[model samples]
Target: MIPAASALARAGHEVLVACVPQLVEEFTSAGLKAVAALPDQAECWAEITDTGHDQVIKVVVGQRLLARGYPELRKVAAWFEPDLVLRDGMEFCGCLVAEQLGIPHVAAPSGAVNTLAPAAIAPLLNERRAEFGLDVQDDPLAIYRYGRIDSLPPRYSFAARGIPRAVAYRQPEASDRCEPLPSWITELDPGKPLVYGAIGVALPTAAASRDGGKASTIPADPVRALAALVGALSELDCTAVVSTGGVSFPRAGVPPHVRLVEHIAQPLLLQTVQLFVTHGGYNSVREAVRAGVPMVVAPLFGDQLDNARKVAELGLGEQATAPSEIAAACRKVLGSSENLARARHAQRELLALPPVDEVARRLALLASAR
Candidate 1:
C-alpha cells in the first residue's frame, strides 16, 4: 500500500488513491492522491469467474465491484469529506462509502481480505448494506468495524480460517517507489545460490487490461505462465533473477544460470536472495516475509491458494505446480535448514510490526476519534 500511502502522506494525511485504471500511474508516482475510482483492468477483472472462492467473493466480487465501483466511490466520498475509508482487501466500494458517510472503515492489506470467509462474505455484504440505506451488519465482522490492516504477523498469517485480528504493519522492505536493481545485477554468481523468479504482476496485469480488447476472465496464459516461470528458473542450480513482470518467455531453453527480467527490484531482490520462486502472491507473501525469503509456491489463483497454504503450513516453504514441481520445490526450499529457520521465523514476525510511521500515527488518531 505504497508504504501505507507514503506514511499517510508523511503524516499530514489527506491521502486519496481510489484506484483501477491499471493503477493511475501507481498512485500518481507514489506521491499519493489518485483516482480512476474503478473500471478497466478488463472491466475490473470481469468478476473473476471459474467461480468458487467463497462463491466468487460473495456472489461475484461483491456484485461486480459494487455495481462498477459505487458511483465513482460515491462521487469520491461525497466530495472528499472523508475521515476514513481506507479500503483495499478487494475493495468493496470502500465499505459502502464508509457506510454511506458515517466514516471509519480501514482494511488495507489483502490476500483477498486474508483468505475470505467473514461468514462467507457477511451475508453478501449484508445484501449490499441493505441496498446502501445502511444499518444492517450482524457482525461477521461488520466489514471489520475498523480493525483490519496487516502485513503479516499472526504466526505468519494468511488470515482466514477464522478471522478478525489485524493491526499489524511493517512490511515495507521495498517499494515506497520501485525500479533500481538492474545494473546487470552485478553479474550474478557470487558462487551460486541466488534464485528469485516471479510469476506475478497479477495475471499479466489482468490479462493485459483490455488496452487490446476481449479475452479477460484471466484463465492464465500469462505467456504460458511466463513459460513455466522461465522453465523452472532454468533448472535451478541457483544464480537466477527472473521477474518477467513485463511478461515474455521461451529463450529457447534458458540457461546461463538464468536472468530474464521485465522488471526486478523485488523487495530489493529479496534482500540478496537464496530462493523465492513465487506466485503465492499476497503481495508476494508479504515480499517473501519481508525478505527472509524461502518460498517456491506455485499457486496461480486468488489468495494464491491461501498463500500456498501459508507457505506449506508455516514451515515457510514448498508447494509446487508442474515444471517438475518447480524444480522440486526449488530443491526443497534450497535444501532446508528447517526451511531456513522457518524463513527466519517469518522474518522475526515481520520485524515485530508497528513501524509504518507508527501505523501512520495510529491511523491518524483513528480518523480523529471519528
Candidate 2:
C-alpha cells in the first residue's frame, strides 16, 4: 500500500492513510499523511501473525478486527470526506464506509489474490454489515465493488474464479535508494557467486528478546527452517548474505561463507545476486522476477505456498519443503539454463505492463467519475 499511496500522491492526489497508531510513523516516514483511526488500540491486528490458528479462529480474529476498526474508520471518513477509498484487500472498513457514503472504493491486493478471497471472509463480513443496517451481499466479492488494481501479470495472479473488474499494473523493480551497504559486505570474496536469502519481516519477533531481558528466539519451526537454509547454503562455494529478520543467532555458529544481519535493503541486494532463496511472498517473487533472478522457494504460510507453486509452474524457479531438500533445489535452479531463460522472460513480461503512474491516473478518473 505504501508504493500505491506514494504513486497516488505523486500523481497530485491529496491522500491521508487512516490506520492504527502503530503504523502512523511508517506512513509518515514514506512522506504520506496518516491519521490514527484506531488510537485506543496499541495493536489491533496482531492476531494476523498467529499462523497456527485454525480457519475458524482466523475468521473470528478477522471479524473482530473489522468490527473494532469500522466505527473508528467511519469517524475518520466523516471528517475526511474522501471522494474514494483505497484499501488493501484485507481491509474491509474502506468498502463499508464507501458503501455508506455512495463513493467508489478500490481493492488493492498486497499479495496474491488467493490470500484475499471473498468466499473465505464474506460470511463474517456480511454478519458485520447487517449490524450496521446495511444490506447483505450475495456475491462474496462485492467488497471489490468499484474494481481492483493488481500488481502482478495475469499469469502470476491467484485471483478467484469470479472478480468484478481488475487492472494489471507491473510493480517497478526494486530501486537503489542510495542506502550504504554494511562495511562487512564490501569485504566478501568477489570471486564467488553471491546468493541472497531472507524470510521477510512478517515473521513474529520475540519481544522478550528484543528487550534487554534475553536474546530473541524465533519460533521453533521457523528457526529450524532458517537453520536448514543457512546450513544448506554453507555447503555451497558461493558467498551467501542472509538476513535473519531480527532472529538472534550465535555468531560463532554461522559459517564464515555466510553473512548474517537483522535487515538488508533487499532491492539493492537483489541487483547483483545470482540466485534468491525466499519464502515466496508476492513482492519478493515479483522483485526477483524483475531482476531476472531465479529462486528456490521455501514457503512457510498463507499464500506463500501458492506463490511457490507458481514459481515452479512458471519455470522461474523450484520449491523445496524440507531443509534437507533446499540445497538441491537451489542447486537445480541455479544450474538450470531453462530457469534462467524463464526468469529473463518474466522480466520482459513485467517490463511490458503499465506503470504505477497509469494506475494512479485510472484511480483519479474513478474518483472523479459521477
Candidate 3:
C-alpha cells in the first residue's frame, strides 16, 4: 500500500494519508501528503488466542478512539476533502469516514487477514461500520495477505451478514511497492538455492512490554542473529540476501557472498529466493506466501511468534529460536524434494490469483459507482 500510495499520488491525485504519526514521514518522503490518523501510543501484547478475539477487542477499542477523534478527523477531511481515501486495513475509522463522505476509498491490509482470521472478526467490523452510519458493503481490501502481495478473498463473511463484499485490492508484483536491487543478487546459480533474510519495520514498543514504565525497543538481537544464520548458511551452497532494515551491519568481518542492503524490492526479491528469513511480521510472512516462497520465521515480539508457529504447523516453513541451526533447517527444507516442490508449487498457485492492478481497476469502478 505504501508503494501504491506513491503510485496514486504520481498519477496526480492529491493523496492525504491518515495514519499513525510514526509512519507519516514514509508517505511524505514518497511525495504524498499525510495526516496523522491516530494517537502515538505504545501498546504491545502477547497473542494467546488465534480465534480473532483479540482483533475483536482491538476493534472495540478502536471504536472508542474513533468516537473521541471523529471531530478531528472530520476537520481534517473537511480541510482536505480528498478525491479518494485509502485506509490501512486494521484502521477502520478512516474507512468509516470515507463511507460517510461517499469518497472512493481503498482498504489496504498491512498484514495478513486470512479466511479464518477475517471470518472470526467480520461481525464486529460490520457492526462497527453500522455504528458509524457507514455502509458495511464498502469494498474489501486484501493487501499483503500473504507473500509480499495484496489480495482479497473472492468472498468475505460480511456478505453473509448482509454486507456484500466490495471490490478487493490485490497485486502479485506491484512494481510501485519495491525498488529494484543491484544485479549481484542475481549472481547465484538458479540450481543452487537462495535465501532472503529480513527484519521489517519495528513497531513502537507495545504497551505490554514498556520498560522502566516506558516504551522500550524490541529486545531481539537481530544483527547478531543474522550473523549466526549467515555462518550456518555458509556450509550450504546457497547465497543469502540479508537486509539490514535501516541498521548498519558491522563491516570488519563481513562475508563477500552475503548481499547486504537496507531494503530490497520485496516482490522481486521473493521471486527467485528459495527461502525467506523474517521477523514474522504479518506483511512479510504473507508476502512470502503470496509469492509462494517458503520461509524461516524468527518471531521477535507481539504476534510474530504465533505467525512463525503457524508457518511451521502449516508445513510451509521452519522455525528457530536462534540462528545457529538455520543452515541445517534450510538444508532440511531443500533436501525434502516434496517440501521444496510444495513450497514452489504454492507460489505458482498463488500467482494464479488476479494481480493487484486488476483489483485496483475494480476499485476505480466501484468508486465511480459511488
- Candidate with best TM-score: 2
TM-score of candidate 3 versus the correct structure, residues matched by position: 0.65
- Writing each residue's lDDT as its tens digit, candidate 2 over 65-156 gives 66777888898888888999988775677788888888999988766454555676677778888987778889876787788987767765
TM-score of each model, paired residue for residue: 0.33, 0.88, 0.65
lDDT of 3 by residue, 161-207 (tens): 32224444445455456677677765676777788877776632232
> After best superposition, candidate 2 residue 176: deviation in angstroms?
3.2
- Which rank order by lDDT, best down to worst? 1, 2, 3
Question: Against the unseen true structure, what C-alpha lDDT does each candidate score?
Answer: 0.77, 0.76, 0.60
TM-score of 1: 0.33
Per-residue error for 182 in candidate 1, Å, reads: 29
Cα displacement (Å) at residue 259, model 2:
2.1
